[model samples]
Target: MAMQDLDPSEFKTQAPDAHGQVSTLKELGDEMKAKLARLGLMIAEEAGAGTYLQRDQTTSLCSTRSKGVEVLPIRQALQRYDWLKDYSWVAVKADTDKFTRDAASAPPDVVQGYFVRGLKGQVERAPVQTCLYVESRSTKQVVHNIVIAEEGSEINIITGCLAHGGIGRAMHEGISEFYVKKGAKVTFTMIHEWQEQMEVRPRTAIVLDEGAAFINNYIALKPVGSIQSNPIAYLNGDNSRVMFQTILYGKGSSRMDLGSRAVLKGRNTSAEMVSRIITRDKADVVARGLIVGDAPGAKGHLECRGLLLSDTSRIDSIPELDAKNPDVNITHEAAVGKISPDEINYLMARGATEDEATSMIINGFLSFDLSELPPEIAKETKKLVDQTMKGL
Candidate 1:
């Protein structure tokens, strides 16, 4: 598939505010509700502790039900608390790239993203759910998100990015920065489902303090025109830890480039990066991972696996590990291959059709041992994976 250069000025930056039209998710049309559910947004009590929903350039909902956590619009949060200036653009520079520059320079009328903060020593029982949807054609959505987990606090977040089917062409640029203070833990899970003609670019960076832990899970299953994302994490304090898991499915003539990098700069710090990619039809995919150990007693690992379902599809895997200290340990493993006929035939002999057998094998291949995730979020992630496999 041929790619075109992105021109920010060509897309509309303003749209009508639909926030007052719907008071709750249940009030939306049934079709729209179902679409949101597929991206891990629900109306149940356990859905999340807070909810933030944005449609085009308008914020439909932003509220926090939990006592210890605070959720507000980014612009409002910045105005309410002057201390936020110290954290903003600290983890991720505003001028890092073209996308970041554009997002940082967005007009004041555009709806900025949401702000989430976990107070010191407070733990939220449920994750915070946020959804960013593009409903207008030829629109440009620029969002800057910030997440802060105070010392000894823990918070989980689930973000969904989707594009309306009626919209013909659109672009999304998201900038996110996360801070995990000493002894704190933060988990973020993101699901992306967009139209085949949509383009997406997300820039994210994380900073971890002493004894902090961060886990990130990302999934993109639906067909899309183009997507490029590479998020980096810095373990700057002693005993800090970080883990990343990404799942990507490429279909039609889409192009996807996704990767993650981690730098272990603290003593005894550890990092891990894992990716699973599957391409069908004439799609193209590139999976990349990098881990650097810069302190003594630090450890890191990188793993990437790719599967090809069609002859015209393409998959590329790149894994790199670097150790600057003699006492550090770093390693990487990567493999790319197609389904073996013998394995498929074995499944077919057990009273299963060809398609069924193939699905079974793919399911088994995508199976993950993620004991770190909360039970509810884990179940939702599994459901999304199963639905995607069935669709394929």
Candidate 2:
């Protein structure tokens, strides 16, 4: 069956269990967790790495455990959510009622937000893993997240979104909004895992204040039928900065289009966007990006590159830039091509089989050196990258 274009702004509401009846957490046995663990790689050894949020059959959050962050259901956050009392560096709260009143005419189906404050140049981490399970065919799950960083504070957040089911189809729509206040910084990393028949689309909007910075990382290597999204960022304050990086792997008959855009609207602001895509099997992919410099001292760059592993697959890179001010600078480059056989032959001559050589070349293409990341995040990202070209 052919999949139609999906709107990331809307999705179906939560339903009852597979049998069409309401079920409690006590009914979701350990066996379900083990089954989901296979798809998410939530193993026993990494149990204490970060917070785990497992969604079996609803839009509500089902927290498994936490390390240094608080986990709450979206409904709970709407009414009763708070930050850690002992943690003096941050303040958090939420009000779903206000959100509903504000969007009274056309309210969102799933609205969730959290407030965060950084304590005077201190750094904190808020990592999350989200899993969605399907009991019915073509299940749609929509989620929205709002994050804020107070002045002079810093925070790093990593998120993993995954889905799995024995028999049924699933779809995910996620929207995220970020506000980086003056003199503050925020870094975000997102990874996705889904079944071969699933679909996913995530929308993102971000704004930076004076002297603020936002770094974003996105990766998706799992098999899914269709995925498409383009996030936007606005650098609206002086000396503000933004960086967007993406890595994607397309498999099966999947169709994936992903990209990000950055706007430099403030003096002395800068932006950078880089994307890498790998398409195999009968997959089709397009990498798109745009950068705009509107202020006198603004600067920006955008790069989009793709590698195809099969003659039957297709890939395209689209990079665009716009500059309004004579003193502003913005540029873009795009390229799409197959792997170089000469590089593979060199590895093959070095005592590696053809498959091993190909894997090495692919890994080299997708690898990103980040010595400043947290150990656990680095480890998990490496695991995903290593698994990208395996069992092809």
Candidate 3:
């Protein structure tokens, strides 16, 4: 079916019962569809070719398109529909099979299906942005593939995943692949917020060619439930570089295992990873950052920190640095602890409530190293973090 023919409302359906309240899956899906439609309308109304091209599954092959910056508004598309708020129980067996099938199909599409599918050629020397949203209930898995190629091309992609309301017991798996060619650069930012009982697993992989660069920034604020994320990057060409930044906050019964790894296989390649996590109530979080420098002239560095807000809260940081080349430089550091009473007292003396003082200190910790993100996204993330902490 054509992308335009696919109505957002058609995909939205009421979620099954979970706990006592209604879920948000249907509402969120409808919102996503509307946002996508609005984005397409905006692109057409603006009538700017080089600056943007909005095509949903419709536009045919066109190589004459100039290499210029591109922007995709995914949240705007989702906003078109009402937000979904609740989900029903999904079997674990079915969810696992769906994920396995999708991964098995990815290799063929990546290797030879590119030509057969009549995919658009590389966007050489231009920046492109794409946004994505997914809403599912009853054990559903989603697979998304992304690729950017050609020399000097630059792309920035942002993705957001949110549960409609509260979930019973469901599993969500997402896979994304990025290919950066010689002298190319790609920056990816992903944000995830789920209901109290959902389980989310997100996996991403990127390959950087000669003189190519890739930067990834991820934020997860799920105060309840479980989330596991694995972000991997490979430097395959000379002078390639990769940087990863991650932040996670967990509260109540939430558990998260989030980390990133980089492998340096070429000369003059470098990788850096930095992450911070906060835990409260009975929540537990395990964060790992790994850098492997195997070739001469390779460099790698990793840093991670965690905050434990309650006595029952748990956090673990495992940073691994492996360097086979004597000329390579590798470094790693980690810390885990709680808020200092001195700082809390300092704020409380200034007429701030205990809860307010704690929230401000914790928020500051998560936002301190996030200066590279867009102001709008960073602000939203901070607000979410503050809201989550309030429930603690």
Alpha-carbon local distance difference test for all models? 0.85, 0.64, 0.57
Clashing pairs in 2: none
- Assess every candidate by TM-score: 0.95, 0.78, 0.68
Clash statistics: count for each candidate: 0, 0, 24
> Candidate 1, which segments miss by more than 4 Å at Cα?
1-4, 15-21, 43-47, 348-353
Per-residue CA lDDT of model 2 for 1-392, tens digit only, reads 33334442243445423233213333444755554443333531234322334353344333523333344444455455454222211111122222222222223334332333344555555334444444445556555555666777666666666665553456765556677889888777677766787676666678788999988888888778777777788889899998888888888888887888888899999988888888889988878888888898899888777888788898878788888888988888877888788988999899999888888877877887544455555676676677655755
Candidate 1 matches the true fold with a TM-score of 0.95
lDDT of 2: 0.64
- Off by more than 4 A, model 2: 1-4, 7-11, 15-75, 78-121, 126-136, 349-353
Better model by TM-score: candidate 1 vs candidate 3: 1
> 15-92 in candidate 3: lDDT tens per residue?
222122112222223554454332221122222222221111111111112334423222221233232000001111
Which stretches of model 3 miss by more than 4 angstroms? 1-102, 105-136, 345-357, 368-392
- lDDT by residue (1-392, candidate 1, tens digit) is 33336665667665536434456777766766888887768732345788888887787878888887899888899999999989888888988977788877877667478899999999885878888888778888888889999999898888889988878879888889999999999999899998888888889999999999999999889998898888999999999999999888899988998899999999999998888888999989988888889999899888888889999999988788888889999998988889888899999999889998889988887876567777777788899999989888
